[model samples]
Target: MRKNSIKNTRINGEVQKELSTIIRNEIKDPRIHPMTSVMAVEVAPDLKTCRAYISVLGEKEAKEATIKGLNSAEGYIRRQLARNLNLRNTPEIRFILDESIEYGVNMSKLIDDVTKKDSNSHRQDEEQDEN
Candidate 1:
């Protein structure tokens, strides 16, 4: 059961794919990190605005630079998108930093640390009990 309309979903997928390609191959701004990716795209129902979630695999400064670069190139991106896709009006692109991947990685590391500590404590408890 999907909440979005079929048209919206299709548009979202197309926009995501096209944007990823554009960012990776077309945009040549040095400020844009090579490790940047279009994680997701959300287009408004009216198809006038689009929010692109970008994930950059780098330091804070690199991420900020990448976002700034992308924002500056929004018009170019929109033109490219319009050329590639036959949409009547290309949505106004907005770049947003997506940190879910980094958050997940940090959370995983924390869980692993806790698990290791628990195992070590259990081992010590077993040794004390045998003594």
Candidate 2:
């Protein structure tokens, strides 16, 4: 299957859904953070390999532990995937830590702070002009 094809997209979505479900409900690993989520999934065109982007809402240690937990359970996760979906080949799963969501949140906060300060400065300038 060609990359970005309809079939590939569908497969990626399916994998992402299943991965989230498995991690959220099935896995009992203590190292896996409860706030962990599957951010995205990219399955190769041949379906031989997959990259799972995972987001954890916590500190650096939590993110690292979550990834470690997921990596340790790769075999079980793959088996679960095969049972849940009828694919020609179950892709080898690789867990990647994704910080985009957290980064975006931080960036938003920074922007808001800047805008607030800018407005406050404008108010001060107006008061000085009036004086």
Candidate 3:
């Protein structure tokens, strides 16, 4: 029943790339953080709604302000989408905060702590064996 046989991944990727570029180059909101980057995009099967995960490299308030700015500019963004993309309908875009980058940093720190502990324990064992 698929018309084009295009996979969801491809469609999602295309939407993500185009939206990110459009947001970066076109949007001129002062509240938008300069470090804002589109982390991921999830488009519905019918391509009517898209959830865009964004990472703002700043404090909580900055992130909030950036989201508010994006929300306010959603109409303009959608219009830009219509101009850039050839889809029959422009999907409603929802901005979401992506904490995966922070989570990954935390996870890496935990791993480093574990690794340091393991190395220290190995050193102590070797010293004991020498004595």
Highest lDDT model number: 2
The global C-alpha lDDT for each of the candidates, from Candidate 1 onward, is 0.94, 0.98, 0.88
lDDT of 2 by residue, 1-131 (tens): 89999999999999999999999999999999999999999999999999999999999999999999999999999999999999999999999999999999999999999999999999999999999
Residue pair clashes in candidate 3: none
Candidate 1 lDDT, 43-126, residue by residue in tens: 988779999999999999999999999999999999999999998779999999999999999999999999999999999999
Clashes of 2: 0
Instruction: Pick out the ten consecutive residues of candidate 2 with the lowest summed lDDT.
Output: 1-10
Supply the TM-score for candidate 3.
0.86
Better by TM-score, candidate 3 or 2: 2
Task: Supply candidate 3's per-residue lDDT for 129.
Answer: 100
Candidate 1 clashing pairs?
A: none
Model 3 clash count equals 0
Q: Cα RMSD for candidate 2?
A: 0.4
User: For each candidate, what TM-score against the reference?
Assistant: 0.96, 0.99, 0.86
